[model samples]
Target: MGNQRTTTLEARVSLAQDPATTPATLYELCSDPSPEVRAAVAARPEAPAEALRPLTRDRDRTVREAVARNPSSSQANLLRLVGDADRWVRWAVAANPAVDTRIRQQMVKAQDKELRGLLAEMPDLEPDLAAVLIRDVSPEVRERLAAHTEDLDVITALLADRTVRVRKGLAINQRTTAEHRHALAGDSSPDVRAALVRALELDEADLQALVHDRSVEVRRSLATSAVTPQHIRRALESDPDETVAEDARGYQAAGEPRTAHRRPIGKRFPGRRGR
Candidate 1:
């Protein structure tokens, strides 16, 4: 009896995994006694919608999650899976590259903050979706959008966000424009300015503002950042804040290679030292 069941499982598993397995065969496996066979069929990108749709409600979470993760799963099925009781199933829906825009709009209002945050990081998130996340109640979700979205308008809007954490995410985001960096340089929060110093490059005007910033933390970050233009680090050597000056001296003592002294040259010819 054991051997008979094992043989059936092997044959079904093989049938489920076969690239040439017909849709009719895959559909038949959905009702197979083994959950593994159902899950394998669910995960196949070419699995027909009819075969995957029923698996979305499979008693086994793995089978349902495989359907959620399958790009070939239809929007209607994905939308249903997005609300699955299992956290992994919902997350899989958010991470699916083929997730439809309408589904993302629903995700924006999901009670789960992590699920909403995952949607914020989608590479192709439309501006309308980005706008909703910008207004998300959770700072973490907004912060993730601020850090990753390439939408300039979204970045611009987030610059005015009341939450310092959201602005800090914008500070470090490479996609932020020169104007955005310059605007952040004058931010009221010392932490925001400090985060700005960690950017890949800063406008000369922004760098000058940071050089004289009242916050020791901002100046200190500027001093230690390997990308700080050589001349800017020299200016910090005489900073009124002793800690800032000390960090500048320490950066020099480390023999960090020479970097361009101004944005025009630094922007064109970046320093060799890996930051």
Candidate 2:
């Protein structure tokens, strides 16, 4: 019996590597006694959903993890795997886009810190689930929600969070509002201030303020913003950091003259540079 199982496992492994192997053959291998056979079948892109589902309960956690990673795994299977005993298995389920909002919400509510952490890191989490995760007990979960959710209210709320990492995530979120941007401008943490500067879609006046921020990192990010005004550029021209100042100078130079003598460099520069 041992020799027969070994031979069966080896045959399945060989079939798993062959491009011409049929899905049916791969599915059969998914139930083989050897975990190695199950893992090999799970790794095949052509492996069917039936094959993946059974492996979710495989005695070997490694084989179960392979099933969790399979792109072909059904949403039902993924939902079940989200509560798997193994941390890595739950993490893999969270990473799967097919897992539904209900499962994500359940994972967010889990008592297991590691499971909650994995759910928080999932970028495709529903907007509502993300909002809830932003208030999770785990700071790591809140930070992940802050980093990925594009919803304005959720991000705004995160901006006021005591956790520096959560605030930093909001400061860099693209959907961040001008109100949030203004708030972050005064943040005590330099990292949050710098990320805020990068995230802010500011007008001329706000850009000017950022360029003059006490934090050199904030000023450096402002100089690199594509929407930075020419007046802001000129203001940063003498900035202490030559690299940042040079970027501002480049913006200024690009705007300088398609038609220079039309107006002085000073007057025309600001209006033209933003375009």
Candidate 3:
């Protein structure tokens, strides 16, 4: 093992850049003074459990996070990471599939909403626990769970959630019912309503309602969406907002039929390439 605590930048770069590194070399690099090297080591799927353990308490946040995400990290190392000061590290631990069942149970009731959201993504959470997460205090967790789970009952509740962000997540989910999509059309947030405009299940009536939205941005989304009804797109060609009117004209010029799953257009014009 290299007794040197620190390496030059070149050496550290080699640790990450070199793909052919041996497991023995990776184990030794686990203790490298450069946190990035340690992070790179933790990033390896073949990282040994013994080497991964000590880095769990590494002073650098990235190093700890890397360990939490490493597939080879042992349950004990992951458990320690579960309590890491950084929320993202704990999030990584919760996201790790190999985390112990006991630790997952503890995470189920954790106060941190991000931790709960990541936990909700795991496939094997208890039904009762899943329910608790659906009704979680944090809208982010609610949204995360709605995005991950196929539970219809949960979808129903999430569509009615007080937070627009949560409801928007439900609206964008293809599985959200048409009834739910229509109900969400009345959401106060234009962002939420605009999200509905882009949903695969959006009702024709809902699509029309958005075309007449007070916000030019909302109307722009309609013209931008590949699925905007021909009538609606025609109406937008005469919109007061020049930008929106131009988008309607562009959509018309392209002459593409409204598709149920059209290329998603945002605030920009349909042909306006790049983000």
Candidate 4:
């Protein structure tokens, strides 16, 4: 009896893998007794919608995940799997690169915060969604958006965000205008201003003002940052705070030339730049 089961499994595997297997045959195998056979069909990018659609609701979780990950899966079926009871299945749908804006909009309403966060990280995120996610309860999502989004409205809104992390992210964003830098230069949090100092150039007026900033941390940040302009570093050498002055002198002595223009490092979301 065991030998018969093994022989049947081998035949199912062979049928599933055969290059000439017809869609009709794969569709027939979709309901095969072996979960492995069904999963194999589900993973095939060429599998017909008819075959992949039913696998989206397969009893086996792995089969459902396979369908969710298949780029060729119908949008309708992918949307159905987005709401799958299992979080892993939902994650597969979220991570599929072929997911459309409509799916992303739907994901914004999902109960899972991580799904919402993944949507927030999309470089091509629609402006309407940016307006909504700006108010997301998760600060991390807001922080990620602040660092990468180029939407003017969203950037303006984040300037008022009470979270220090969000403000800090805005401070370093390449999209921040000179006016934005002026506003951040006077930010209440020393850390926020410190992050701003990492930008290659600051409005001359803002740079002069930051030279005398009350917080030593902000001055020290400007003093030690590789991107700080030469003039700013020179002024810091005379800072009232001796430690700030020492840091400025030490950094200058190292002889690393500052960039002539702004070169924002890590300013854009990964894999989304130049889009």
TM-score of each: 0.84, 0.72, 0.67, 0.76
- lDDT digits (tens) for residues 85-200 of candidate 4: 99888989978888998798888888888777778777878998998889999898888889888887788999999999999989988888888888999999998999989764
Pairs that clash in candidate 4: none
Give the alpha carbon lDDT tens digit for every residue of 1-275 in model 3: 55455558567757654668776777777777778788887877877787688789889999999989887888888878888889989988877768877778778788887788887776656777777887788878888777766677777867667887887787677766778777778788888877767655477787777777998877887887766677878888878888898787776435657544233365446656655
lDDT of 2 by residue, 203-250 (tens): 555666777788777777777666566677678877988777666665
Flag the better candidate by lDDT, 1 or 4: 1
Clashes of 1: 0
Q: Which 10-residue span in candidate 2 carries the lowest summed lDDT? A: 258-267
Off by over 4 Å in 1: 1-11, 252-275
Candidate number with greatest TM-score: 1
RMSD of 3: 8.9
Residue runs of model 3 more than 4 Å from their true location after superposition: 1-40, 94-104, 120-126, 186-191, 208-220, 235-247, 250-275
Query: Runs in model 2 with CA error above 4 Å?
Result: 1-10, 16-28, 31-33, 44-50, 112-114, 121-124, 220-233, 239-275
Global lDDT scores for all candidate models: 0.87, 0.73, 0.77, 0.84
The alpha-carbon lDDT assigned to residue 245 of candidate 1 equals: 75
Candidate 3 versus the native: TM-score? 0.67
Ranking by TM-score: 1, 4, 2, 3
